[model samples]
Target: MEKKDGSIDRKYIPILVLLFMGAFIDGLDTTIVNVALPTMAMDFDVSMSNSTWIILGYVLGLAALLIPAGKACKNGRVKKFFIAGTLTLLIGSVVCGFSKEYAFMVVFRTVQGIGAAMMSAAMPSIIVRLLPPDKKGIGMAAMGGASGVALILGPTLGGFVVGVASWNWIFFINIPFGIVLVLLAMHCLPKDGVPDPSKDPTPLGAVSVFLTVGLLLVILQNYGDKDQGVELMIACSAGALVSLIVLIYSIKHDRERAIISTKMVLNRDYILLGSAFFLSTMMLTGTQYVMPYWLQISYGMSTMESGMFLTISSVAMLTIVFWVGKLVDRRGGRSSSIAAQLCRLVLCIVMIVITPPDGLLILAAAMVFLGFSQAFSGTGHTTRMIHHATPGYEDESTNFLLVINYAAAAMGAVVYSMIIAITLPETTLLEIADYTVRMTNDAVNFTAVAGIAFLVLALVLSILVPNRVPDKSGKASEASDAPDNASE
Candidate 1:
C-alpha cells in the first residue's frame, strides 16, 4: 500500500480510527476512576491511603511495561501487539468489574495498564508511518481530540454512572469497546514480519526493565511515609537502586540490536522534546491528581458537579490542540512551544494567588487556560520530536517519548500524594466511611504547590526551546514523487 507521494496508502484511516478509540478509552479510564475511588474504598474496606493504590497500581503497571512494549512494536510486531493488548485489557476489565477484594481489583487494574502501555506505544508510530507528512498535525490532532473528549466527559460520565448504576460499571463498560477495537484493529492494521532484532532474544531483559520501573515507583510512593516501617522503606529503596543499575546495564548491552534503539535517545532533538514532555506531564498529571479532591472536599460540591467543571478544561484543550497543530505546521515547533509555556506560566501565577472559597471561579478559569497551554506545548513538542526521528527509528522514538511522559506522570502522582498526606494532619480526614468529608487548609496548600511546579516548568521551557524552522526535506521529497496533476 503506497501513496502518490510515496507515503503509506490513505486506506489506513480504519487503523487510525482504531487508535482514536483506544486513546478515548485510555483517557476515560484515567479520570473516570476518580469518582469511584471512595466507593471502592468502602467496598474493599481499605484505608484511603491504601485505596489510592487503585490508581497508583495502574500507573505503575503502565510505566513498567511501556519501554518493553515499544521495543516489541519496533521489532515489527505492532499488529500482533495491538490484538493481544486489546484482548488482555478486555479480560482485565471483566475481572476488575467482578472483583470483590481490594487485592484482586488492584491486580486487574495492573493488567489493564499493561494493555494501555502496549497500545500507547504503537498508536503514534502507526500514525507516523501511515499518514502523509502534511497531514501529520491533523492526524495527531485527531488523536488528541479523542483524548480531549474522554477527559471532558470522564468525570461527569463516571459520576453519573456511579450515581445511577454501580461503581463496577466503570470497568464493565470497557468490555464491548475493547472487543470492537480488537476486531477493527485486526482487520485494519497492516501486517509485518517479526524478527528478533537483538542478539539476546531472551525475555529476561524485558522482565528486568519492568521490575526496575515498578520498584522505583513503589519506593517513590512510600519514600516519605512515616507510618510505614523503616525496614520497608529501606527495602524498597535498595530494590529501586538495584533496578536502576540493571536497567542501565541492559540498555547498554542491547543499545544497537534492541527494539528500543538507544540511538533515538542520543539525538539532541529527541532529548529536548522528551524532557519538555516530561515536564508537561509533571504539571498536568499532578494537577489532575489533586483537583477533584479539592473540588469535592473544599467546595461542598457533588461529584457530578465537580466533574462537569473539570470537563470545561477538556473542551478548551480540544479547541487549542487543533489551533496549535496548524501553527506548528506553519511556523515550526520551537517558537510555538516557547509561546505556549509562557502562557502556562502566567496562568499558574493566577492560580497560586487566588484563595479557595473566594477563588473557585478564578481556579476554573485558570484550568481552562491551562488546558490550552498544555495542548500547544504537547502538540508542538511532539511534532518536533517526530520530525527529527531518524529513518526506521520512528517507532522507537515514539515509544521513548511516551515512556518519558508516563514516567513523569507517575512521579507527579506520587509527589502529589505525598504532599497531600504531609500537609494534612493525621487527625484530619478527607473522607470517612459513609460520612461527610471536610476540607482543611492543607488541601489548599497542596494545590498551591502544584501550581508553583507548573510555573517552574513553564519558565524552563521558555529558555530551552530553540527558535528555528523544521527541516522539510522528507516531506518535499515525498511530494516530488507525486504525479504532476496531484500537486496541490
Candidate 2:
C-alpha cells in the first residue's frame, strides 16, 4: 500500500497490526517460557537442566531453519510463508499444551520455533516491501513497541498465569491468539508474484549454513556447564568449524546461488552495521545476564523484586524507541545511532566509577540509561541497516540481523557468566554478609567494564556508517507487485 499525500494508506493499518502481533507473540514466548520452566520441570518430572531443552529445542529449530527461511523469503513468498508459519506455530502450541511426555514437549517446541523463524524472516521484508519509504520507521517502531510490551509483560503475565493455573495455559493461551493472527494474515497480507527458481539457494549452501549456526548455538547454550559439556562443546566446535569451511567453499564455488552471497557478506556498510549490532547485543545480553543476580545479592532484594525492577528498563526502552524511530524517519539512522552509543558509553562509565549504594536510587538511574541506550541502538542500527542494504539485498540484511541477534544473546550470556564466575569464584548469595555483597558488587562492576569494550566497538561502527547509503530501489522479488492484494 502506497502513501497518499505523505500519509500512510488506511488499508495498511491491519497489515501493521498483524506484524505487531507477530513480533509480540514471538517475543512474549521468549520471556514467558523462561518463567514457566520450573513448573514445566515439575510437571514433566524432569530435572531443571533437562527441562531447559524445552527452550533449547525451540532455539535449535530456529537456528537450523533461519538461513533456509531467509533464503526462501528472498523470492518474496511472504504471504504464503506467514500463513503457513502461523498455522505451524498454532499446531505446535496446541500440542505443547497437551503434551504427555517431556520428549513430546521438546519436539513440539521445535516445531513452534521453526514457525517463529519463518515469521521473523518475513516481517522486515514485509515492512521493506509493503510500507512506503516514509512510513517504514513507523512500522519498525510498532514492531519494536510490541516487543517492548512483551518484554515488560511476559514475566509478570507468566507468573500470574502459572501461579493460578497450570503451566499448560501458557501454550493454550496462544491458540485463540494464533487463530486470530492466522485469519488476519489471510486477509491483510499482500499476495506475492511468481518466484524465480534460480534465486533459490543451493541445498549444500543451505545445509552448511544451518550446521554452522545450529552447532554454534548448541555450544554457546551449554558451555556454562564446563564439567558436563566439555566433550559436547569440543565436538560441536569441530562440527561448526567444518561447516564454516564448507560454507565458504560453497559460497566461493557458487556465489550467485549461495545462501549468503559473498557480496552481501563483504559489503562495507553491511559489515559495519552488523558488527555494531553484534557488539551492542552482546553488551546488552551480557549485562542483563549478570544484572539480576547482582541486584539480588548486592541489594538483598527478592527474585520477584529484582525482576520487577528490571521492567523499568523495558518501560524506558519502549518509550524511547518510538521517538528514535521517528527521528530516523525525519533525519537519519546514523545520528540517532551515534547518540545512543554515546549514552551507553556514559552509562558504562557511571557503572564503573559510581560507588554501589545501599538503596536502589543509583541502580534505578542506571536502568533508565540502559533502557535509553538499548532503545536508541536497537532502532537506529536496524533502520540504518535497512537503509544501507544493497538494493536487492534487503532480505539478506534482515536475516543477518536475526542471526547476529541470536548469536550475541547466547554468547553474551555465556561470556558474562564466565567473567562473573572468574571474578567471584567463591561468592554465594546464600550468605547475606557484607563481604559477599562487596564481592558481588565488584564482580558486577568488572562485568560492566567488560561491557564497555563492546559498547566502544559499537560506537566505532556507528561512526563508520556513512551519512547516507543507497536506498533500496523498487523491490525485485515477487513481493513488489501486490499492494492491491492487501485490500482483498
Candidate 3:
C-alpha cells in the first residue's frame, strides 16, 4: 500500500492538522477550567466539593463512551463521528460560556467530554491507518508532539487568559478553532465504510465493559475515604461483585467476540506490555495531578508561577521522546524499557528525598529529572505495545492498551486524592504564614504514595515483559543491539 513518489501521501497532512487541533483544544479545556475552578465556584455559589462535578462529569462521560467510540471508528463511521463530535464540542463550549448555574455548567461539560471521547478514539486509528508501517513511529511522534506541546503550554495559557481576561473567554476561544477543524476535516478526511457486522458484533460484550469500568471508578473514588458509611461501603462492594460477574460472563459467553478482543488479551506479550503501560501512566499522571498544587500551596506561588516551574519537566520530556523513539525502533523493547524504568526509579527517589522547604529551584531541577523519566518510560512502553500487537488488530490492540493506561491514570488520581485527604489532617506541621501547609502536606503524601507504587510496578514489569525485536545474530531476542534506520 505504498503511495506514489515513495512517500506517505501528503493528503493526510490536513487530517493530521485537524486531529492535532482537536487534541490541543481538549488540553486547553482541561487546564483552563482547572485554574478557573475557584472563580466558577464563587460565581455559582457552590462548595468546592460540588464544583468538582465539573471535572467528574467530563471524566464519566469520557469513560462511558471511549470504547464504544472506538467500536464506531472500526465500523467505518469515523468521519461522521468526528464531525458530530466537533459540533457537539462547539455547542458545549458555547453553553458553558453562557452557563450561570453549576448544574447547567456540569451538563455542558459532560457534553464536551463526549465530544472529546469520540475525537480521541477516532484520531489515533485514523493516523495509524493512513501512514505506512515504516513511517508510523514518526507519525506517532508528530501527533505525540502536538499533545505534548499542549500539555506544556496549557496551564500557562489558561492562567494568563484567566488573569488578564474573563474565565468565559477560555471557552469562547475554542469556537474559531473548532470551526476551522470541522471545515478542514470535511474536505480532507476520507470516508470509511461500516465494518463487517458478520464478524462478531459483540453488543452485549460492550455493555459488560461499560459496567466494569463504571464500577471500577466508583470503587476507586470511595477507597480510603473516612466518610464511607455502611450504605456506601455496601454499594461499592456490590458494584465490585457485579463487575466481576459481568466480566466473567463476558469472558464465558463472548469468548470469541468480547469487546476487549480476547485474542489480544490472551497473548503473553500484550498482557505484559499492557501492564507496563498501565504502571507508567499511573506514575506519570499521578505526579502531574499533584505537582502544580504542590508548587502553588507549598511555595505560596500563583497558578502562572506554578505552571512556569512545571514547564521544566515538559521540556525534558520533549527532548527525551525523540531519543526514546529511536531507541525503541533500534535497540529492542527490553533494554529501552528496563533502562527507562530504572531511570524512573532513581528520579522518583530523588523527588521523595528532596521534600518541600528545599526551594523552587531545587524542586524544578527534580521535576526535570522526573519529566525525563516519564518520557523515556512512556515512549518505550507505547512502542513496545504497538510492536507486539497481533497483525490486523493494530487498532484494537493500541486502543485497548491506551484504555488501560487511562484507567490506571484515573485510579492513580483517585488514590492520590484520597491519600492527601487522609494524611494532611494527621501531619504535625503547623500552618505556615502565606502558605497552605495542609494542602502542601497532602500533595507531599500523595507523591510519596505514587512514587512507591511506581517503584514496585517497574520491578514487576521488568521481570515479566520480553522484547519485540530480534537480535543481531538473526536469533529471536528481547534486547537487540542493532541500530534503527534513521531514514524512516
User: Number of the top candidate by TM-score?
Assistant: 1
lDDT, candidates in the order shown: 0.68, 0.71, 0.64
Descending-lDDT candidate ranking: 2, 1, 3
lDDT of 3 by residue, 95-211 (tens): 988888778887888798788777767776875677555444444555555556666776667566766776777788778888888888788778778676644436666666556
- In model 3, the worst 10-residue window by lDDT is 426-435
lDDT of 2 by residue, 1-488 (tens): 44545555688889789878998887777666755664566677653224446666665566567666777876868888887887888788889888889989988988998888787878877887777765577788778778777777766666567767767877866667778888988888778778888877788987887788767756654544434447788899999999999988988987777777766777787788888888887787666655654665667654455557767777988978878776666555777677777767766677677665553676688778877876776776777777777766777877777777766765665566556545654432222233366776787788789888998888888787675422234321221112331111
lDDT of 1 by residue, 1-488 (tens): 33567454567667658767988877777788876676677677754455667887777677777777777776687788787877877788888888888888888889988988877867876777776665566566667778888887788887788778888888877677788888888788889676575632236557776777776767666655556788887787788778667667767776664435566777765676677667767767766766665566566566678878888778888877877766665555666566566666555576557655678777778778777776776677667666667656776776766777777777777766666666654522434353323333355466556756765765575456454333333341111111241223
What lDDT is reached at residue 205 by model 3?
62
TM-score of each: 0.88, 0.82, 0.84
- What would you estimate as the lDDT of candidate 1? 0.68
Candidate 2 Cα misplacement greater than 4 A, ranges: 1-8, 34-57, 94-109, 165-168, 221-226, 292-304, 345-357, 421-443, 469-488
- The alpha-carbon deviation from the true structure for residue 81 of candidate 1, after best TM-score superposition, in angstroms, is 0.8
lDDT of 2 at 18: 88
What is the Cα-based lDDT of residue 319 in candidate 3?
80
